[model samples]
Target chain A: MSSTPTALPDPMTLREVYQQQQPYTRMTPLLVSESLSKLIHGDVLVKAESLQKTGAFKFRGAIYRLLLLTPEQKQQGVTAYSSGNFARGLAAAGKILNVKVTLVMPADAPENKIASAKKLGANVVLCQQMEPSREEAAQKLSEDIANQNGSILLHPFDDPEIIKGQSAVGVELMQQLQQQQINCQSLLCPVGGGSLVAGCSLLFDPFHTSTQVFGVEPEGYAGMNQSLLVNHLSRAPGKNLSHCDALLARSPGKANFEVVRQTSVKGLRVSEHFVVEAVQIAFEELKLVLEPSGAIALGALMQYPAQFRGQTVVAIATGGNVDKALFTELVNK
Target chain B: MSSTPTALPDPMTLREVYQQQQPYTRMTPLLVSESLSKLIHGDVLVKAESLQKTGAFKFRGAIYRLLLLTPEQKQQGVTAYSSGNFARGLAAAGKILNVKVTLVMPADAPENKIASAKKLGANVVLCQQMEPSREEAAQKLSEDIANQNGSILLHPFDDPEIIKGQSAVGVELMQQLQQQQINCQSLLCPVGGGSLVAGCSLLFDPFHTSTQVFGVEPEGYAGMNQSLLVNHLSRAPGKNLSHCDALLARSPGKANFEVVRQTSVKGLRVSEHFVVEAVQIAFEELKLVLEPSGAIALGALMQYPAQFRGQTVVAIATGGNVDKALFTELVNK
Candidate 1:
């Protein structure tokens, strides 16, 4: 696939993708954080994608992906598997475009996410937990369903199309920052399959020479961090306790890892405790509600403030779709 | 004063205020709520000023007020009184403009409010709860401080300039709505001293012809509501066991009420129960953390859904500065 691969797309193509998706998406605010600026002694901007359609940034990629489908393919529909965020995003996108979408999700996915996907008219198949990660199990089941229904199978994050769609975040952020005359020194993004970070790093530092862009992941599931350290795709010990259900991907996507290496994306690992604290801080200071995975990039700041002090930074809040009880418990804690 | 009353300003003045305040404040997002749209069967845009600087719409007025002070007045500084939101807004505004500020507050004001004022280098005088009302007592002390210090005594929400400054919210909202091609049929703004609603009503329906803009107040502190019912200023029973600390004004401001009467602004009163529910829903559905007073306008919808079921509505989430403990309890409940 690498030998015959197409050349990486240019920035204009990415910007066009963002512009096309504008009608189907909300241009989430680029909010300046006063409390964070005081803490860092520099400007801190939050790209609040938590307020995006379906309450996550995944909708950008999902909608863009569906828009690119051929007329026949759209009529035939598509199949995919996701933990939660991607499922809701894809479901909503499919519903909007009048395309049938079948999703295979883990049985233990959040109730609200599952309910939201079903409400958006997605046919959901709940896969039981299995070896090689619940995601892999769901993926295998999704492939089988796609074959049975003679439908196109779409990868949630590994596909180049998905990565290109995710580039909308970088394009939008750069547009907003330029309008405000803010030159960001560092950017932090929560990494699951690494698509968002990879897409953004390509835009912010295509040559991988400067502009520190860090991908934050939970401690035990820091596959992107581990992979970057050895300069190769590597798996992490994903069998640890974590509240960030959306960020438990054991390994980065193959295409995503390739882009990260090319763009020199840095990685950070945060503990659940810091993630919980970040959620509370987001609610209190930022006035935004972020799920644990969504707050991990913020946790990276709290975990190592000295490293970023006096540097202009931007953090991407990825999703906000936790169950009310879980959200309350995290807030109380 | 009414013998030759100062003429009310025009929309050009309001747009200029927003332009001048652009650098000092955030262009808060005008977000369409998908969940809310589904519930109401029409569009529901949330003009979230909760993410505004110093955590409320009061900052727009406070900063514009300070910017408008005469050179001598700016050097001498200013004195004002507030329950919580205005004090923080004015203090922060003064600090930014290098003007000394003195604030008179009720002794029982929120701890965070007092700390925020002091942190911004404001001299705070805590007035004891005496006869009349806590706000009235604070107002009297503020006047004395202004006279002793030879400082300008600024009303929190009474002056015409202050009203014009607060008009930024309406101007900004209209710009956003027009960009989206959305015709706002109904607008809901939480009312304390009535600046926000008055400014917005004037912009949307100056001749009292169309566009129903409602001033929402707490159940017992419905001073703006009571005042608009008659054609004259009237007081409300502000004594209530509620947690909306930022909205305890016993009566609408003199100038604010006059503007409301001219604009033919309508009003609504919400119970504390729905306010709490709105806060929780904000966390759950909208991915925003709104203070109870900020969430009261959303509560107006929950209180009487029938009145606004099929209309395009916009609710103003005014501030996001409630105590963490109180927020947690409210979210948990």
Candidate 2:
């Protein structure tokens, strides 16, 4: 009888990822607070991706993809599609590596992102809304470039290498906890493409503690929950419902979903209204700007206080690259 | 024949002031930058007063006044005037120090500041604005409070101890410069009431090098500049032209003014239009929110970039608590 080989227990070793990716990515601190602890009825720590270079955690995956390139590939450069954080990250990384880049962005991307990418010397391509999705339009552009000039396409997530790279955040989190001598009961992170949570689970698996990890998604974009319940894959990359434009992954990453399925982690969804309230609370109380997607974990904490009470929890404060106009709209309203 | 003792090189050593007053004050960091170096033509560093706890440097002097209170004085609490940073600082410090504070504010004071003061547990006494000088009415309130119950009055500036406490920013700056091993050619700080620039001069004076200190004042509030030409004090505190409301300080501190006069520093005034532009640049380029007063130095940089072309300069980004509504109004326009 023939048996299928067991999948690797670890997606990638923490040490190897650190050595390969540490130079390019930020070691965003796991900031803990006495005040936050008191309010949440437990010790609370925030992995401040808002403070990450380029103002988002997307840099970790983008830079990791850049690192795997051959010198020739580096010279030829790469291309990707994102309307927001990823666009900024790829452009920024391209500027640092002195590599030419082509970006396929939605025509309605934030002006700041467009200007920032242009400032970093990326040849930005505007796509029509006629395409069903920005991701599909971008994939088509990537294929065209691959056929014509053999340029590499850097997928934002769903790529195994990118998933492995995002796992570095977990490694950093564990290292930081050890340094501070603080033991956490659970890890709470926002789910976008599911790669971040998927990669995190692999890192947490070896600890062998009953420390449960939870992934939060905006209520409208919680495709991961439905996928996990029935084990059926969705056709696309984002969920159908989301006021948070960033967290609208229609489907989870296949590899990441596999890892997340095996881990003893629970997933939860938060309402768009709660996310807005969380954003306001962050500004008024913590003096932080948490974009709608970034506030999902905090929104869960506020909406369901009992679920998190008495547990030492770590929440990822994902990013702070808010459009000035959108920020005014939300804050003023 | 007898003569009064000559003033000490640095009168009223503020080391003790800083130590005892620290709890009541927010120790704003003097953040040095590599990015700013590209614009100022030298190694440009920003002392980010914009990041101060109450979002301005005025908190330093307000807290210093509160800290210097005698036991009897502390029991009765404190009172002050103005509808800007000082009001906010007094309220915040008063809450922490367990002192009751009553502020005489103009009816036109930004709703944000008034609300912030109320949130911090200060009693607000709104006054009519028909009077040409609101400072006069504030002084009257301070006197009445002193006469009735011996409540201490905290002046926005023009107090020696306040000047001494404000000097601590200078102290921190010199230490930061030394730690970074950067030999700064000059220090440029906004000249509001002159306390900030004056205090900074004292801090820079002890360096034993020919370091020029410059002050940037809003064009409308050029009281300090006019005063400098005549070698005579001009415009009583809070009685002068007010464009940058936070910098409406008419008179420089006597000791602070003396230091500015004695030092080899220059003063430059930038237009309001340029100030708005600088504030925009701050938001776009530096990813910071700066009030008009806070952006005055950046305004100066835009107006006369050549002046800073070759020298290692430090510009104090002195405040950031602009009314969000006002900021939207100005920037959107």
lDDT of each prediction vs. the true structure?
Answer: 0.88, 0.70
Across B147-249, the per-residue lDDT of candidate 1 in tens digits comes to 9999999999988888888889999998998888888788999998899988887688736334688999998999999988876788998778778888888
Residue B46 error, candidate 1, Å: 0.7
TM-score of structure candidate 1:
0.95
Query: Candidate 2 on B38-117: residue-level lDDT in tens?
Result: 66667766676665667677777777777778878889888778657778888888877788888877777667677888
DockQ of 2: 0.17
Q: Where is model 2 chain A poorest over a 10-residue stretch in terms of lDDT?
A: A1-10
Clashing residue pairs in all predictions, respectively, total: 0, 8
| lDDT (Cα) of model 1 | 0.88
Q: What DockQ values do the models have? A: 0.70, 0.17
Collision pairs in model 1: none
